[model samples]
Target: MTEQRLAGKVAIVTGASRGIGRAIAERFGAEGARVVVNYIQGGEGAAAAGTAIEAAGGEALAVQADVSQSAEVRRLVRAALDRFGRVDILVNNAGVMVAKGVLETTEGDWDRTIDVNLKGAYLCSKEVAPVMIRQGAGRIINVSSNSGLYHPSAMRFTEYVVSKAGLNGLTKAMALAFGPQITVNAICPGWIRTDMVEEIDPETQQRILDETALRRWGTPGDIAAAALFLASADADFITGELLIVAGGRGMH
Candidate 1:
């Protein structure tokens, strides 16, 4: 059997009901981490995530919380502590995308995007930082996006891009604040083949593939693998870095 890299660790993965977040939670579970699967909606999906984790030979607990709200974030962390006694890793994967151009974005669209994408990460991290600091070790992985960086598609989702950009900044700041004990990082994915992305028109999809250096859509597992690396001891010396899991998008 392959080594269980995260044996005995407890990890909390926010927005883990589906897509990239679910993939990361399951991957961590397979690697031997007790997972706290968090989701704001879709109870069935979150329950499935927990079941998958247990089936993969790790324990799992499902929690529902809106990470954008400080009280709920606190409740989420408290549940983890009450159940697992300690939290060794936090994957801030909860985020919302607003598909509007800068000029077309409404105030509500901007607020919701920032609240969920940027502020959600902040609230979760804030709740976990102290717990990690007291333990003298922990890992925080933020699920950001290439749009947050220099991707051409960034301009298409104005609020989403801005929120993610803010998240990138928070990742760096948290890395510094968390210090030598806790390693903070971000994974910036591009065009992952989620259900949403798969719904894009074929012509546009092909254009995206053609522009990617790998000529393929990145899978959720691709991002999950990166998250696993960041959460495990393999990244003990790594911090404040944004690992891009795109199919080499924007490289052209």
Candidate 2:
């Protein structure tokens, strides 16, 4: 039998009830990592993910928490430690996008996007870093967006782009702070077939596909594979890097 790369490891995947987050949780579980599936409100999906993991002969825990809140973030980290003993991987995958332009975006919309997408990553990283440092080794993967980079027509998602950009910066800062103990990195995924992008109009979607070298939207599995690679021993020397998983058109 082939050995599992993440055997005996524990992973915390925030916003893991659906889409990219769910994919990451399932993949981690299949690789023999004890997974904590976190969701803010999607309890049913979160529970289902845990059930699926167990059915596949893996251990999983479903955790409900608002990653944007420090208290809730702490509780999530505590839950993981209490259940699995220690956290070896932390995937900050919870994120939201506003469909409004800069002038059209309300104050609440802007704040909520920044709070959940940017601050949430910060809170989760902060909550788990000390524990990881004590363990002497850990991996932190932030699921950022291609919009955070030079996109030709990404002005509509001002708040989301700004949040992702900030997340990239945080990834670098945390990597520097953690040093040889923990590795912090970000994944900048372009137009993926996720719930978040289901709202895109047909014309825009087709335009994206036409521009993409692969002529298709990236899948959650693609992002999950990247996470698995970064979490593995092979990535021990990699840190504070932005790994783009776009299908050629990194930004459109």
Candidate 3:
């Protein structure tokens, strides 16, 4: 077995049942972090993720919780503490995407989007921050999106974009609020080839690729690697910063 970088550390990864969150949970487990895989609706996927982590020679526990709910978020955190004793890392990766023009977006759509994406992050961070501050060292990584950084007029996901934008602001705020001990940061991923992206049409997918500097789509592993780096000791001094992983698509 390879040397584990995160040996003896415990991590809580939200929405770890699938996609980018699943990838991050697996990666963290492989690095020797005892992982808490939090999922909302996919019990089977969450169990599978935990099993994979254990198969990789690391520990994992699958928990069900809606991150947007304060009580549920607290329960998730308590469960992690019960299983792992401490949470050295927290990855707020749970989010939702709804594509619609701002003029056509309904209040219900906006509320749901904000609840899952923005409010979820806020609730999870609130529950974990105190624990981290007491521990005197921790990492909080928020999985944001390039859509929040630079909005493309052609793509219509008004609610989703706004939610992510709010997340970016929250990341900075938490970083400042819990500084000198914990480092908080956000990763903005672009066009990752996940189940979410598969929902788009082929022509639209190709257009996204054409815009990227790499002329290709990113994978969940790409974003996972960024999360690992931010959680690691190498990023001890970095905080309140938004790391863009868009393959230069939004840039040019």
Candidate 4:
């Protein structure tokens, strides 16, 4: 068998019940990292992910916590430390997207989007920062979206776009804040074939494919591979950067 790049490390992945988060958790586990999969509501999904991790000859635990809540974020971090002894990698992958135009977007919608997508990233990172700082080395990866850059007026989702854009800024700020010890970066995915994207209309899907150089939708595995690289020592010098995994669609 090949050597694991993340052997002996522990990683905490938020919103890992399904989709990209789930893929990241499994990938980290495969790389020999003891994984803590954090899910808000989907207990069964999280459990299944943990099971799969164990099946792959890795250690995993499923924990429940809403990232938007400060207390919950603290609890999640503590749970990881309690189970794994330390947190060497943190993947802030919990988020919600609401598709609506600016005028149609309500105050509650805006707040909810920001709470889960942007604020949740902040809370999780804050709770884990001290732990990483004490260790003198760590990795924090934020899952962002390409919408943060293009701002396509044709597509709605104003609140979602705003939250992702803010997350990009947060990624850079945190990277600079904890530099030379802990590396913070963001992965901006363009069109991944997650359940969320499957809900898009056929016309929209075709349009998206047409815009991409690859002419195909991306998979969760693609994003997982990028996350793995960012979490590994291979990317030790990388910080405060946004790696776009958009199948060349978002290229100007």
Q: Count the backbone clashes (under 3 Å) in each candidate.
A: 0, 0, 0, 0
Residue 175, model 1: lDDT of 93
How do the predictions measure up, each by TM-score? 0.97, 0.98, 0.97, 0.98
Which pairs of residues have clashing backbones in candidate 4?
none
Task: Write candidate 4's Cα lDDT for 156-197 as tens digits.
Answer: 988888888999999999999988789999999988987766
lDDT of 1 at 241: 92
The lDDT of model 4 is: 0.92
* Candidate 1 local lDDT, 1-252, one digit each (tens): 989999999999999999999999999999999999999986899999999998877899999999989999999999999999999999999887765678898999998889999999999999999999999999999999987896785568888888888889999999998898899999999988875465566877788888889988898899999998998777889999999888888752
Off by more than 4 A, model 4: 151-155
> Could you tell me which residue pairs clash in candidate 1?
none
Models ranked on TM-score: 2, 4, 3, 1
Worst lDDT run of 10 residues, candidate 2, spans: 147-156
lDDT of each: 0.90, 0.93, 0.91, 0.92
**Cα lDDT over the full model 2:** 0.93
Residue-level lDDT of model 2, residues 195-223, one tens digit each, is 89888889888888887898888999999
